[model samples]
Target: MYTKPPIRKIIHVDMDAFYASVEQLDNPNLKGKPIAVGGDGKRGVISAASYEARTFGVKSAMAGNLAVKLCPELVFVKPRFERYHEISKQIRAIFHDYTDLVEPLSLDEAYLDVTENKKGNPSASLIAKEIRARILNEIGLTASAGISINKFIAKIASDYNKPNGQKTVNPEEVISFLETLDIRKFYGVGKVTTEKMYQKGIFTGLDLKQKSLEYLDTHFGKSGRYFYYIVRGIHNSPVTPNRQRKSLAAERTFSENLSSEIFMLQKLDHIAEEVSNRLKKSKISGKTITLKIKYSDFTLHTRSKTLTYFINDKALILDTAKDLLYQESLNNSVRLLGISLSNLNTEAKKNTAGLSLNKKVSVQLKFDF
Candidate 1:
C-alpha cells in the first residue's frame, strides 16, 4: 500500500486595511485617527476605511453620509491609485522572489503556492514569516499570512491571524479546524448565501462537508459543488497571471446639462479625437464604435456600430459616433455624452496586404495601428 504525505504548504498574504493604512503610513499626523478614502458628499461612498473607522461601524461601500454618521470625526481623503499600484508592484516582486505561483486577489491580497519554492526551504511557516517581515521593512506596512495544504484552507487560516500575524494548518489540522468555522467565515459565501446555509442547518464546516453532492446541488445550484470541496479543504484553482485588457472606456459628468445636438456633436468629435490618439499610442484598433448619452433626469442610452475591419483614424471614429447619435430618439436634455470603441482588428484586409508600395503607404497612414 502507498501512503500519501499528510502536509501541503500554501500561503495567503493580505495587507492590513490596505488603502487607508497607506494614507496613514505616509502621514504621521493621521495616525490613530479614523480615516476613509473616497468622496465626501451625499452621492459618494466610502472606498476604504481604516481599522479605526471600522471600530465605529464604518465600512467600505457605505454611503459617505452613513459612514460619517457612524464616525463623526472620521477624516475623508481621496484615493491615491498610482502610489498604491507602485506599492503593490513592490510587494508582488517580493512574492516572485519565492514562487512564480502568485495569484493576486486584489491590490492587497494574494495566494502563493510554495510546494516547491525558490528558497528551497521545506517549512512554509518560515517563508511566510520572512515575506511578511520584508513587506513591513521595505514598504512600511503590516500583513497577515496563513499556510495550509491548499488555497481554500490557506485563505481561511490567513484571516485567522490578521494585522501583522501568521498561522499554519497542517493536513491533519484542516478537518478539525474547519469543522468549527462560522458558516459566514467561508470564502465565496456572502450574506444571502450565509442566510441560506443557516436555514439548511449548515452552521459549521462539519455540517457542510457531511452533505452529499446531490443534496448540496439541489439546495445551492452550481455553487454547491464549490462549497462541497472547500469544506473538505480541497481547491484546484491555480495562480493565473494578469489578463490582458480587452477594452477601455472613459466618461465624464458635465457641470450642467445641455440640450443642443450641435454641442453634443462637438463633444463627441473631441472624444473621438482623443480615442484616436490613444489608439495610435497603443498600436491598437477597434471595429465597433459605441455612443453613450445620459439625460438630465438620469435616463441613459447607447448605440453601437461595428465595421467590417478595425480602424484607428480620427475621422472614421467621429463619423461612426455621429451616425449612432443621429439614430437615437433624444427626448430630454443630455447631461453627458461619451464615445468608446471596441472589437479590435489587428490586421489589414487580404487585398490590402498585397497593395503597391504607394498604396501600402496610403493604407498605413489611414490606419496607423
Candidate 2:
C-alpha cells in the first residue's frame, strides 16, 4: 500500500541572542557593543553573548577567561532571570494568539504548529512574519522565523538568516534544500558525530542520503536511522504543546580541578543550591537525585538514588547529592559536578491524535522527546 505523505505547517522562532538583546534593550549604553550575560569570575561560564561578542569567538558555555581572551573588549553583565521569564511568557502569549500548539525549547526558542491557525490564514510564511513583527513592535526585540512542512526543516531554515530575518522552505523545495546543507547543520549531529560523519565521507545531506540504512544503522546505531530519514526530508516529530518537564538540573565546571573530597563537597553544595532554586521556581518536586561528575581527564561517571518521596529542599538535595558522591571513590580529580532531580510529579499530558503524512505513506511515530 502506498500512502501520500502527511503535510504540516511548522514555524520555528528563535530570538537573536535573547539575554544579551534584552540587556541591550534595557540599557541604551550597551547597544552595539560586544556583551555577554553571565558571571565574570575565573571559573564562570558564559550563558549568552551578543552577536558582536560572537564574532570574536565568545560563545555560551565557554569559560569566562577564555571569552575575555577571545574578545578583549567584551563586556559582562549579570543575568536578570525574572525579566527574562516575564518576557518569555509574553512571547508565548503572542504564540497562543495564533495557535494552541506551541512547543517551547527554552526562554528563547519555540516550535509552533500553524496548520489550522486562529486567524483562518492559509499562509504559514505570512503568519511567521507577523509573529516576528509583533515581537519586535511589542516587546522591542528581534526574532528570526522559519517556516516549513515539518519541525526538522523548519528548525534548520530558521538559522539560515539569523538576527531578525525569516526563511521559508516550501514542501516541494525541501529535498533540494537539504541536499546542499552541511551534515553538521543537521539536528542531533554533535561535534563527535560530525567528525565521524566527515570520516565516512558524509559531508552533506546528499552524501548521507546515498548511504544504505543498514550501513548507517551499523555505524551510527539508532541515530543512524534518524539521520538517514532526516536527510531525505522525512522527520515527523510533532510540535508538542504543554510538555511537562521531566527533570531540573544545574552543573558547573571549575577552572582548576580539585582532588580533595572536602573541595568536591563544597562544589556540590553550590550545585545543590542551584538545583533546589530551579525546582522551587518551577513549583515541582521529584524523588530521584542524580550526581554527575566529570574528571579532569574528561572521563564521566554518574550516581543516582531514588527516594520514597518527592523533595525540593536544598538541604535534602545537598545531603542526597553528598551520599551519591561518596558511594563511589574519586577515580581522578574532578573538573565538573552536577545535581539533577527527576521522577517529577507534574501533570502528564499526551496527544493521542496522529496526523496523516499521506494516505499512501505509513510512518511508525515513536515519541522520543
Candidate 3:
C-alpha cells in the first residue's frame, strides 16, 4: 500500500483598509466618514481610502483632485507611516504567537504556514480565526483570513469575505473551487492578462483547464505554465519566514512641475538625502543607484549606475543621482523625482538554515483542515 502525501495547511491574513482603518481607529471623529490618506494638492496621490470613501469611487493611487471630484466630502490626510509601522509590528507579534513560518507580503498582509504551528492546532481554519481575533482584541483592528493548501488559493479566499471575515478551502474542495472560480479572481491575472484570457475564451478556470499546456505557453509565454499549474491548485511556493528586502527608495511628487535643471537639482538633493537616511536606518548599503523621473505628461523614466562597492552616504548618492540626471536632457517638465538603491547588502546574506528552498514540495496525504 502506498502512503498518501501530506497536505500543507496555509493561511493568508489581510488587514482590511489598514491605513484608513487605523486613521478611523485613532480618531473616532473620522469614523464612518469618507477619508483618504495622502496630500490633497494637485500632485497628491491617494495612498489609501476609507471604505466610506471607496463607496464614492475613491481608491488608492487615484489623483487627489479626482478623488475630491468623486466625493466632495472626501477628507485628505497626510500619511502617518511611522504610526503604521508601529502598529504593524504589534500585529506581527500576534502572528508569532501561533507560527514561526510567517511570510509578510507587506505591512498589511502576510502568509502563515500553520501545517506545523507553535499553537499545535490541527485545523488551519481555527488558527486563522484565533489569529484574527487576537489582532482585533489586542491591536484594535479588523482583519480577514483565508485558509487553503497554497498561497495562491489562500490569498484569493481571503478576499471572498471582505472586512473582518475568514474562509477555508479544504483539501477536498480545492479542485471544484478552482474550476468555478472566475479567471479574473485567479492570483497573478491582472487587467491585461484578464482581457487576453477573455479574448481566448478563458473566462473561468474550467475554460483555462481545457487548453493544452502547449496552447497556453504559446499564448501567455512563460506565464502559461504558471497559469496551468495554479488553475489545478498546484502552486507549491512555501511560506518563507525570512523574506529579504531587495531594494529601498524615496520619491517626492511636486505640486508644480519643474522645467529647469537647476530646480530639479534641489529636488534631487532632498530625495537623495531621504534615500540615504532610509538606507542607514535599515543598516544596509547598495552597489546600484537609480534615478527615476516622471514627466508632467505622466511618462516615467529611470537611469541607473552600478558601482564596484556599496555606498550609503548622502553626498555620494546625491553625486551619483546628479550624474544620471544630466546624462540625458529633460524629456518634459518634471513632476516627480525618486532615487532607489538596489543590489542590496541584504541580498548577499545566506538563506535561513533548516528551511527548504525547493520550488515544489510533495503533498500526498490529505490534511484534516
Candidate 4:
C-alpha cells in the first residue's frame, strides 16, 4: 500500500473555559479556584466552567443547579460580554499575526492551516508554541493546541493535551492513532451514536476502516463515507478566512427609559432570533455574534461572543445572546437591542455543502456540542 505524501501542517487551537478564564485573568481573586460563568437562575445554564471546576464534574451547558451541586464551592459570576469580546479581539489579532488562513471556530477556538505559513517556519509546532507564548504573555490566558495534517486529526490532537498543553500528530502516526482511538472520541460522534456503534462492534478507527463502505452507507448513511475517509487520514477541508459577513442587524430605538431586566432580555432575545434566522437562511454559521444595547442615558454597550465552533443554528445564537444579556444586571433603562452574526462559514467551513447534495444525510443531530 502506498502512503500518501507528507501531511499538511494544520493546527487547532482551543482556549479552556474561555469565559471563566477571562474572568479569572481579569481578577486575581478568581484564579486557581473553581469558577463558573452564567446566571444563577432557575433557567440559567453554565456558560463556561474553569478547569478546576471541571475536575469536580462541572461543565458548560450544565444547568446552574447541577453545576453548583457538582462543586458546592463553585463561584458563579455573570458573563461580561464586552470584556470577553475584547479578549477575543486580542486573541484573533495574535492569530492574524501568524497567518491569514486562520478560520475561527468561535471566540475560543480556531483552525489554522500553516502548511505554507507566512512566518516561513516549516515546523508548525514552533508556530503553535510561539502563539501560545504570546497569548500567555499578552492576554495572560492559556490555550491548548492540536497540530496535525487535517481538521479531523488536528481537532483530536488539540484535545489530547488540554489545559495549557499542546499535542502534535505526525503523519506517520496517523494510522496507529486512529486505530486505537475510542470511537466516542471521533469529532462528530456523540453518546447515542457511540453506544450504537459499540453495539455494532465498531469501537475504533480500525474497526470503522474495516467495515464496508456500503454497509456504513446503508446504516449510518452519508456520514459513513466521511468516517471511512477520515479514518484513513484523508480530509480535504481548507482553512477559510472569516471575511465575508452575511448580515448586519441593529435594534430599534426605544423612546422610554426601561429599567425592567426581564423586558430588556425579552427584547434582546427577539433581536437575536431575527438575526439568527437570517444566518440559517444563508446556509452559514458565524463565530462572532454581537449584541448591541443602548442605555436610557445613551450609554451604549456592544457585547460580542466568538465561539469555539461555528454556530449555524438559530437557537444557539439566541441562547448565547440571552446568556450575555443575563449577565448585565440592567438597573438602567435600555434604548436599543441589536444582534449580528459575522464570520460566516468559509469554503471548508461548509461541511453541509456535500451533505446537502448527499440524499442519504440524516436529519438528526447526532453529534454533541
Candidate 5:
C-alpha cells in the first residue's frame, strides 16, 4: 500500500496598517481619522497609511506631496522604530508560546510552522485565531492571519481578510484557491513581470500552470522555474528561522539636492562610514558594495561592485563608494546617498588575517537606473 505525504501546517500573521494603527492606539485622538505614519516634508515618503487614508488613495511609499494632494486632511506622524521593535518582540514572544519555528518577515509580519506545535493543537486555524486575539488583547493592536498547508498559500490568505480577520485554506482547496489568484498576486511578481506575463497570455495562476516547465524556464529564466512550481502548489521552501541579514546599509536624504561632486562625495563619505560602523558592530565583512542614489525627482539608481576580498573598513568603504560615484555621470540632481555591504563574511576573524594584504581591485559597476 502507498501512503500520501502528510500535510504541513503553516500560518502567516500580518499586522494591519501596523504603524498607523499603533499611532491610533497611542493617541486616542488620532483614532477614526485619516493618518499616515512618516514624514510630511518635501522629500518625505509615506511609511504607512491608515485604512481611512487608503480610502483617499493614500499609500505608503508615496511622496508626501502626492499623498497630500490625494488627501488634503491627511495627518502625518513620524515613525517610532523603538516602539515598533518593542511591540514586535511582544508579538514574537506570543508566537514562541505556540511554536519555536517562527520566521519573521518584518516587524509586523511573520510565518509560523506549527505542524507539531507545543500546544498540541492540531488545527492551525485555531492557533492563528488565538495568536491574533492575543496580539489585540495584549498589544492593543489588530492583526490578520492566514492558515494553510504551506507558506505560499498562507501568506496570500493572510491578506484576504483585512484588519482583524483570519482565513484558512485547506489542502483540498489549495488548487482552486491558486487557480483564481491573479498573476500579480503571486510572490515576487512585480509590474514588469506582470506585463511580461500578460504579453505571454498568462494572467492567472491557472494560465501560468498551463505553461510547460521548459517554456517558463526559457522565458522567465530562474524565476520562470519558480513560477512553474508555485502555480502548481509545489512550493517546498521551508519557513526559515533566524534568517541572516544579507546586507547592512545606511542612507540619508538631504534637505536640498546636491549637484556639486564635492558635496556629493562628502555625503557618500558619511554614508559609507555609517555602513562600515554597522558592519563592525555586527562583526562581519562583505565582498559586495552597493551605492544607492535617489534623484531630486525621486527616481532611484544603484551601482554595485563585488570586490576580490571582504572588507569592513570605513576608509575602504568610503574609497569604494567614491570611485563608484565618479564612474557614472549624474543624470539628475541627487537628493539621497546610501551605501550597503552584502555577501557578508560572518566569520570576521577568518577574513581579518588577509585584510591588510588585500589590494584595491576594480570591478565594473552594474547599473539599475
Candidate 6:
C-alpha cells in the first residue's frame, strides 16, 4: 500500500510598515503620527510610510511634495539603512530558531518552511505566532504572517491581516481561498496585468481558472501556465535559503534636468564608483553593463554592452557607461541616470526539497494548524 505524501507547511512573515515603524520605535515623538522615511525635497520620494500616514493617502514611492499636499502634517525622516539591516539580522536569527529553511525576500519579509522545524512542533501556525511574538518582545516590532501549503498562497495570505495579525489557509481550503481571491491580490499581478485581466473579463481567480491553458499561454505568454497552476493551488516551489543576487546597481535622480554631457559625465562617475564599491564589497563581478536614462518628460531609455571578461573596476565601468551615454543623441534633458551590472559571477544553489505537483490534497488528512 502506498502512503500519501505529507503536505508542506510554509509561513510568510512580513514586518508592518518597516522603515517608518523603525523610525517611530526609535523616536517616541513620531509615534501615532503620519510619518514618511525619505528625503523631503522637490524630487524626494517617500520610501516608507507609517500606518497613520497611509490613512492620509501617504504611501511608499509617492512624491514627497504630493504626500505633503495629501496630508499637511506628514513628517519626513531620513532613511537609516544601517539600523534597518541591524534589526533585520535580529529578525532572521529568530527565524532560524524555528527552521533552517528560511528564504528572505527582503529585509522586511521572508518565507519559512516549518514542516520539519528545529522546534519539532507540528503546527506551523503556532510557530508563526511564536516567531511574531518573539520579534515583538525582543526587537520591539510587530509582524504579520500567513500559513499555508506553499510560498505563493502563504505570501498572499500574510497580507490578509495587516499590522500584527496572522491567517492560516488549511490544505483543504487552498482551492476555495484562491478561487475567491481578487485578481489584484494575486502576488505577481500588477496594475498593468490587472488592467489586462479586466479587459479579458478576468477579475477573480475563478475567472482565471475558467480560461483554457492554451488561451492563457497565447495571451499571457509564459505567465499563462503560472496562472493556470496557481489558481488550482498547485505551486510547488520550495523555501530556498541564501537566494543568489542577480544584479547590482546604483542610480541618482537629479532635482533639475541636465542637458549637457559634461554634467552627465560627473554624475556617471559618481554612480559608477558607487556600483563598483558595492560589487567589491560583495566580492562579485559581472559582464553586462546597462545605462538607464530617464528624460525630463519621463521617457526612459537603456543601452547595454556585455563584455567577454567580467569586470568590477570603476574606471572600466565608467568608460562603458560614457560610451553608452554618447551612443545616441539625447532625446531630451535627462532627469535620472542609473548604471547596473548583470550576468553576475554568483552561482545559484539547487533546491532539492520541492513539493510534488502531483500530490493530491486530501480532506481526510488531519489539518493541525
Q: In candidate 6, what are the lDDT values of residues 272-337, reduced to their tens digit?
A: 999999999999999999999989877889999999999999999999999999999999998889
Predicted candidate 3 versus true structure: per-residue lDDT over 1-369, tens digit per residue: 223224689999999999999999999999999999995745788899998999999999888888988999988888999999999999999999988999999999999988988988899999999999999998899999999999999999999999899999988888889899999999899999999999999989999989977899899998998887777777767898988899999888889989999999999889888899989998999999999999988899999999999999999999999999999998899888999999998895554223232344233436688
List clashing residue pairs in candidate 1: none
Highest TM-score scorer: 6
> Model 4: how far is 99 from its true place, Å?
1.1
Could you give candidate 5's per-residue lDDT for residues 124-203 as a string of tens digits?
Answer: 88889899989999989999998887788899999998979989878767778888899999878999999999999999
| TM-score for candidate 5, residues paired by index | 0.90
Sort the candidates on lDDT, descending order: 6, 3, 2, 5, 1, 4
Q: TM-score of the candidate numbered 3?
A: 0.90
Q: Check candidate 4 and list the clashing pairs.
A: 106-307, 106-308, 107-306, 107-307, 146-158, 251-337, 258-333
| lDDT of all predictions | 0.79, 0.88, 0.89, 0.78, 0.84, 0.90
- Which tens-of-lDDT digit does each residue in 1-369 have in candidate 4? 223333568889999789999999889999999999984733356789998999999888676767877788989898898898889889989988878899887789999878887888888888999999999999899999999878888999889878899998777677788889989899999998898899999998899988877788888987888886677777777787764555456465444556777777667767767776766676777788877777755577888888988886767877888877876676477756778877666534445323232232211112111
In angstroms, what RMSD does candidate 4 have relative to the true structure? 11.3
Mind giving the per-residue lDDT tens digits that candidate 2 earns over 26-79? 999999999989948456778999999999998998878889888989999999
RMSD to native for every prediction? 13.4, 4.6, 3.8, 11.3, 10.1, 2.9
Report the Cα lDDT for candidate 5: 0.84
Instruction: Give the Cα error of residue 260 in candidate 6, in Å.
Output: 1.9
TM-score per candidate, chains pooled: 0.70, 0.86, 0.90, 0.70, 0.90, 0.92
Q: What is candidate 2's TM-score against the reference? A: 0.86
